[model samples]
Target: MKKKTFWIPIIVFIVTTSVLYLCGHLFNIESLKWFNFEETSNGGFTFGGSLNPIIFGFVIGFIAEWIYKSRNKNRTA
Candidate 1:
């Protein structure tokens, strides 16, 4: 894969995760609570059931990259 193709998904994943987490926390949405950060006993923090977001973000990232590639390829061809 090209550098942009590889990095696009990663960037999208990061952005998606960050945005979801922030929205979940800031909005105090019950359904999105899983994306919020949880306080641990050790004065540190842990992700609150972030598995869904991780998978969702990755899938969304790949889909976005796929669409982007297809559009660009069509344009060039």
Candidate 2:
């Protein structure tokens, strides 16, 4: 796979996580509040609270990768 193609998934994951984190911290809006019911703080990171972003990152990464691969295949065909 091309380096640019590989980075697409990573970029998508980072952007998704960042957007979720910023929305949670700055706007006090928890898009994934359903997953986080308890409060647990460790150092500068919270488990339940922070896990949402990571989960979202994975989800977004998968979706982005799938889409990217699909488009590439179509273009090549």
Candidate 3:
């Protein structure tokens, strides 16, 4: 990813995941699962439903950014 587009993949994943989740509900499909995949079967209310993806997305984005940035940094140096 370029500097200007560094966040693109992660954002796309999050947005796509959200859209799929919504569509899953609309279409009565149970196959769609969050990338984080921590859904509880008890039908209880939990912030994990939303928080998991953000944390997962952030951690993934940070790791990818770190790796690509370091690769470029070392190459430039």
Candidate 4:
């Protein structure tokens, strides 16, 4: 990957992971089993999520990078 485009994937991965975690924590989405929130004595939820977010983030980031490259290619062609 080009140096310029490399940041795209990294940024996308960070953003995706953050948003998913936030949504899971705030909304308590039952669909995502990874965001296993356990209540503590303080009445606050603890994050027990798995690495699924990392994997999914990487995948989405790759797709975003590919799309960006394709668009840039077409524009320069």
Superposed Cα deviation of residue 32, candidate 1 (Å): 3.1
Candidate 3: count the clashes.
0
Comparison by lDDT, 2 against 4, better one: 4
Give a tens-digit lDDT track for model 3, residues 1-77: 37434675576557755766676557645454342244468965443233444455566666666776777789899
Candidate 4 accuracy as TM-score: 0.69
Q: Report the C-alpha lDDT of model 2 over 7-73, residue by residue, as the tens digit.
A: 9999999888877777776766666442345444753534355587888799989989899989989
Q: After superposition, how far is residue 20 of candidate 4 from its true place, in Å?
A: 0.3
For model 2, the local distance difference test gives 0.76
Residue-level lDDT tens digits of model 1 in 1-77: 48888888899999987788677668887455564566899899866454656677989998989998998899889
lDDT of 4 at 52: 67
Residue-level error in angstroms, candidate 4, position 37: 6.4
- Relative to the true structure, how large is the alpha-carbon lDDT of every model? 0.79, 0.76, 0.58, 0.80
Give the lDDT of residue 72 in candidate 1: 80
Q: Which pairs of residues collide in candidate 1?
A: none
- In model 4, state the lDDT of residue 74: 94
Off by over 4 Å in 1: 34-48
Better of 2 and 4 by TM-score: 2
lDDT of 4 by residue, 2-66 (tens): 88698988999999987776776677775434556678998887766567667889899999999
- Please give each candidate's TM-score: 0.68, 0.70, 0.43, 0.69
